[model samples]
Target: MDLHSALIALRDPMGIPFFPWLFQGLMVLTFALHILLVNLVVGGIFLAVYHHVKGGEYGRKLSKTMACCSTVNLSLAIVLGVAPLLFVQVIYDPFWYTANAISAWWAMVFLLVITLGFLSLYVFYLKREKHPSGFGFFGLFALVMVVFAGVIMSMFAMQQLLPEKWLSWYVVKGSLQTLGGGFHAFSLGRFLHFMVPAFVNIGIYMMLYAWYFRPRTDFDQGYLDWIGKSGVRLAKIAAMIQVVIGFWWLFSTPIKFGFYRNPVFLIGAVLGFLVMVALIMVQKDPERYAVPMGIVSLVAVLGMSAAREVLRMGYLGQFDYSIYQYPVNLDWGSTVLFLVTFVMGLVVIAYPITLVFKLGRGTLSVEEG
Candidate 1:
């Protein structure tokens, strides 16, 4: 059988329980949230380690703050990741499962690595107060493990796009390779495109940090000013670097796909450019601009996520595959259940999130009283 036919044959005979577009849309939304939290985790942890090693009053304070935030963000990122992954499995089971099967060992190891990364980060966070510089290695170790996990995921994502190469990867010199130990494909440009944003998001996070604490009497105005200035500078530089990486990834795509002219991609690009411009405009008053810029960043991220989905469609289109054409059994019962449960979950989670927000800003007592 040809590659396209085989892909169709591999799809679930039971069909999806809802329309493919709905699942795809949810996947994009959840992925944007997941990736945003992931960026916070990665950038927060790295900054924590860097500041912890630097060891000054401001550095130590910032280090502790970042470490704590990273711990929280890591948990949220992992939880949010599940929804997008499930959506992918539902809408593109053939490609997702095939990619996993091809690198079964790495897939299994991914869980363990992430677990270790989290544990190491927590250990560093808890011990940093006592050991100070002594436990810096743990933070470094966690960062490496986290980055390695990302690399494995990137490899899986890249592999699924190249269905034509799967057979050769699975069979070497006429012998079936069942071990699934090899990493078949990766794109440095694409990986960097995803990773470079971590710094940008983290920089914005610092701006928000300053804004959040500005009203607190305990925080020094000098420190807040330093953080705001530093954040704006970092965000501006990282935003520029992200633009370069974005174009590098775009150029890396096959010219035949003409993604450069694709309207969806262009819209995403424009949103990104606007985000960068907004960051630049906020340099004079990061704390004042923090909330609006945060909202803008989220909208831009959603646009980019949509563009990412479009790119995936283009890649699979080469094989005569379209997610919108997926067979749907249309089980309204399950769909309703999922939506209701999802809404209820948000309601339940909101209370704690609100409490944390208030507590962080030292307003919990006022609200409670």
Candidate 2:
């Protein structure tokens, strides 16, 4: 009847199918992959819109490229999202499902919003070449919708941790408010904390895009230089903003001393800041450090994700709940099979991305915008 009682009632009877740590690890890894692609899609949309409006031959080419890649990125984000969702349900089902129930309407609408967003992006891609002006509006519209969808999902995820507030959120004056009016609470700093770095990530990606095609394409040296220089500058600025946003989110969170002082949080926060510094430092010679910068960016994602898990656990500690407390069924056969299939699926999915990059090494023909 109470929040703690409700959560206990909702937990899976089978408990975790295998080791709790292992599932948690898989969730972090898969979620990192999902968010990385999400950054590309979100950040790629920003770049595409910026370049399209600039109205230059190189700008048009890059804009079109990013617009086209967005559809692919969205698909990959959806694909990579499934595993983490499953793992989350496996380990944190009580929290996850309760959050969904609190915001039931918005939770259901998330799928619809994604479908519409994807369709809008597809339209943007198709029209970008022939109806450039029309596509720009569509692109902007799609970006807003997709971002809203992300915000809703994030709010639900965070809402789960605040079990104590769940009942208050669900009922007011002895009346049920389960519909939630398509609204949910989310941290502005936390949302921007992820969104800002996405731009930096995409900036690094653009530099690599420029570098890879520089030798093959007949693109003007000035244009390629602009790509490299602009990307570095953009990444630097975004990284700086992310630092401020990161701290804002940190201070805003109601963390206990143990969580606030935990080495996991400390190390992750420090490493993330250092990674940004490294990215800024590498900007002086982007071409040489593009690969390393990209890898470090991913490492930052992993570190941040781990820190998030730490915070989640710490929050649950209030109710004296721990993922390790979940009963284990020890289904090793299914667990091993799932792990193998997950790895194989990643390999399969990666092949196409690798081929796309390989093919992208060719010169791009610019369309007049």
Candidate 3:
């Protein structure tokens, strides 16, 4: 069969199990959260680096602050990834297991590398010895390397495992060489484009978080003038860079033009564009717009990223993996269950807002009205 035909076959699963669409929705939600946190860590670190570098005499304090955020974001990146991964395995066990197995070495060593990265992460702050911001540099390096490894494995897995009609490794390599046009057959190219934006977005979020959680007393001219101004500038610039590089990476994939032709792909692309525009506007008027912009932009990002993953699972450009199929099952019970939780979640989210308003109101009454 032709390459495209083979690709479509990967999506042709034997059958659907359990509450298919509902589980898919859950998987999507969890995956989105995982990516959101991933960006925070990536962008957060570099922003911290930039802040510490520019803070002049305030460098130490700024570094310490940045370190705290970096560590927390890193932790969340790993911790919050559980549900999506489990759900992915449940549905795509063949693809997931096969991919990991082919790149077994990388997958196995990942634990050690992650541990080392964390050690570097801990050394970044836990120790006061050695170089200044010592661990920070190493931690940054380690994290980048680990992410790169994941990229390599993913590429190998996607092209290699997706039920390639049980083709042997050599035949696959031969075909890939003919198809990839002199590029390395097993390479994923994840590291080249994604790492910077990951770091940059995370940095932006941290700065944003700082801005969001600013103490009213400390919301003085200096804070706004120095930190806010500089932070906004860096984050927005990084945002622009991410947009550029993201497209570059997309096109770099063999899939390219046809990839965007997919309806789901188009939706993601449009939402992603909307998000960038919203973020830019918020950057322009941070106080009035930052919170909402950050939120909406994040949603757009998550949607785009999840769709991207779905496409990847389907092998967007080159081939669609046909090992699994999911029927669109309208799950009423699941819908009502999560719908109630969703509304309740809104109320829970509102509590903090209400408390903040109450405190601000009481403080304002004492001081003015």
TM-score of each: 0.97, 0.92, 0.72
Summarize candidate 2's per-residue lDDT along 196-263 as a digit string, tens digits.
87888888887786688777746677777778887877887888888888888888888563666888
- Per-residue lDDT for 1-369 in model 3, tens only? 875564344442544445555566777787767777766665555555555445454555555666666687777777767667776675655556555554456565666766776566666655523455344576566456546544653464455434544345425656632222211234334343345446445534544645554545644445444555555566666667666766775676556436656677677667666656665666655645556656765776666666656566555323543323444344567568866996898799897877675565344355533
- Candidate No. with top lDDT: 1
Candidate 1 wrong stretches, greater than 4 Å: 364-369
> RMSD per prediction, one decimal?
1.3, 4.3, 6.2
Candidate 2 regions with alpha-carbon error over 4 angstroms: 1-5, 178-182, 217-221, 347-359, 362-369
What C-alpha lDDT values do all the predictions have? 0.90, 0.82, 0.57
What residue runs in model 3 are displaced by over 4 Å at the alpha carbon?
1-17, 49-55, 128-137, 149-153, 156-162, 170-194, 218-221, 254-257, 313-369
lDDT of 1 by residue, 1-369 (tens): 998899999899999998888899999999999889988888899999999999898889889999998999999999999999999998888999999999999998999999999999999999999998699999999999988888998898888898999899999999987998989899999888778888888999999999998878998989999888888888889889989989999999998889999999999899889889999998999999998888888887888789888899999999999887788898999999999998999899999989888887887786594
Backbone atom clashes (below 3 Å) for every candidate: 0, 0, 21
The count of residue-pair clashes in candidate 1 stands at: 0
Question: Candidate 3 at 255: error in angstroms?
Answer: 5.0
Candidate 3 accuracy as lDDT:
0.57
